[model samples]
Target: MADDSIRGISRRKFIAASGTAGALALAGCTQQNTGGGGGGDDNGSGNGSGGGSLSGEVIITGSSTVFPVSNEFAELFMDEHPDVNVTVDSTGSGGGFENNFCPGDSDINGASRPITDEEVENCESNDVTPVEFQVASDALTVAVNNEADWVDSMTFDELSQIWRDDGAQMWSDVRDDWPDEELELFGPASTSGTYDWFNENVIGEDYQHTAEHEPTEEDNLIVQGIQDSQYAMGYFGYAYYSENEDSVKAVEIREEEGDDPVAPSLDAASEGTYPLARPLFIYASEAAAEREEVAAFLEFYIENSGNDTVAEIGYVPAGDDVIEENMETLEEISG
Candidate 1:
């Protein structure tokens, strides 16, 4: 994928200007570009602290919601260890686990939600033990077209009434004073963690999510669909909504009718005030973590999970305590 990292800067420039020092600090390794590719001194440190240049490939796939963070980190990590090739793909979380990750094709998988028991069983069938790491937090954002100013906040019941199958066909169906225009829905497909979370939390178990809406793994497509119509509404990760705030309006969410509506934001998510706030993660394959480059890249990722760049990319960065716990987990899994 083209480097759509922060500020539209080239990957080389981003690395030269800021990533090098940050990466070095995170990995605690000095990069020595030997004229020729040579295996680093494998001091049996398993944690990637060996001396010399690290070389190899690390493949990451999963959650479109967590893709931005993983993709950015991969670029930065690759720049620090030029001989290491890191690739991140935005396969929906379930799709990744079922196809690439559980099948042992990817070293790591990013996920917006925790893995299911079925997924764990599948991974075990392939002998891939998945190690979970919380990398960040996201406020799942429900957005509507910028021009649709009839409503700004919605209660969980109202949200359910809109998303649940055969529940609401028009805006007026949810509330009396709202517009009578037909609701144009857009959202993530069944393979997406966002879809699962939304269904379980907002739509509830009694009803099914309407299939009348457009569904895709690409969040940008949801944004585009919302942008195209005045009555369009959809939900996706907060990062996508933040990046396209001008084109769409996020709906404030109230847990119940009497509760105040909470707007989706990094602060709201971090404070646990946002109704849709959820943790984002990356699962490392235990077998792959033994590889020097994969372990090194994961170390860098965990160390920088709380960095400013995470918030800059429009999500709540992991706190110091979370990072500490994650590092311990990384060490254990890699060891």
Candidate 2:
């Protein structure tokens, strides 16, 4: 069954970005899960189910940021292997790792952050080992209202000056040419994986001024906040920003000395020009991989979908060459 723990914005944003809108008929799935023991029809379809039947259910849960990518893949996979029933749950990256990655129980888990030593221990604690798969990268895009004209890109140093508590809080505070209202900040809650990434990569882990505003795990909340205010600044994974392209504007972060500050376009993000781009992932237990359903799902997922789904979801694709390489990795590992 699905969990209603997260607010609505994340779901809506995901639906918008991932082309889940195409399957609008399949929203709000609520089938209760009994620890992923169920399987599906042995003769699943598209991409050729490899002449096998998956008789059980495959439960995947993890980072909301990673959900769209995986979910899009999952949907396509299910289309390929009719017998393979798969379910994806978005309980935040941290929640999935903490609650669902029980070695003997859950099959796969996704995380927005890299696994910690403690979490590795946690995986082993329940006898479930973890394997990392770098799926795609994302950027923590800082966006503003579309009407904003005085600024274009920002530097980490400049970001720290504007966001960390000690930095002036208003758009005008950073520059005299900008408006003089107090700086308004919106961002993910402390528990979010993106939050940690933003802290370490963007603002430094020891940022001084983060306490002045709301820290929400919901990207949609941050999106709404930013959309509603002109003086506000916020960050979320690239896909969220992409989905709301009509409502928000992505700010560029200045990089090389000769290069123009670049916004988070698919081209810039894929080529690594976007400063905040990062690899996304999911960890599957060896036991999970051993299952025909799991194997077929992953095989079909990487095969039929891959980077196409990434682009469909509004984030940059991993590129056709990268997609082929990932397929090769899966074939080698699964074989």
lDDT of each: 0.79, 0.65
- For model 2, what is the C-alpha lDDT against the true structure? 0.65
> Which model scores highest in lDDT?
1
Return the TM-score for each candidate structure. Answer: 0.86, 0.78
Name the Cα RMSD for model 1.
7.5
Candidate 2's residue-wise lDDT over 29-112, tens digit each? 112221012222322113435543556677888777777766666665655555666777776666677778754556777667
Where model 1 places Cα greater than 4 Å from the true spot, the runs are: 1-52
Q: How far does residue 77 in candidate 2 sit from its true spot (Å)?
A: 2.0
- Global lDDT of model 1: 0.79
- Name the weakest run of 10 consecutive residues (lDDT summed) in model 1: 35-44
* Superposition error at 277 for model 1 (Å): 0.6
RMSD of each: 7.5, 7.6
Q: Which stretches of candidate 2 lie over 4 Å from their true place?
A: 1-48, 102-105, 165-167, 205-209, 256-259, 319-335
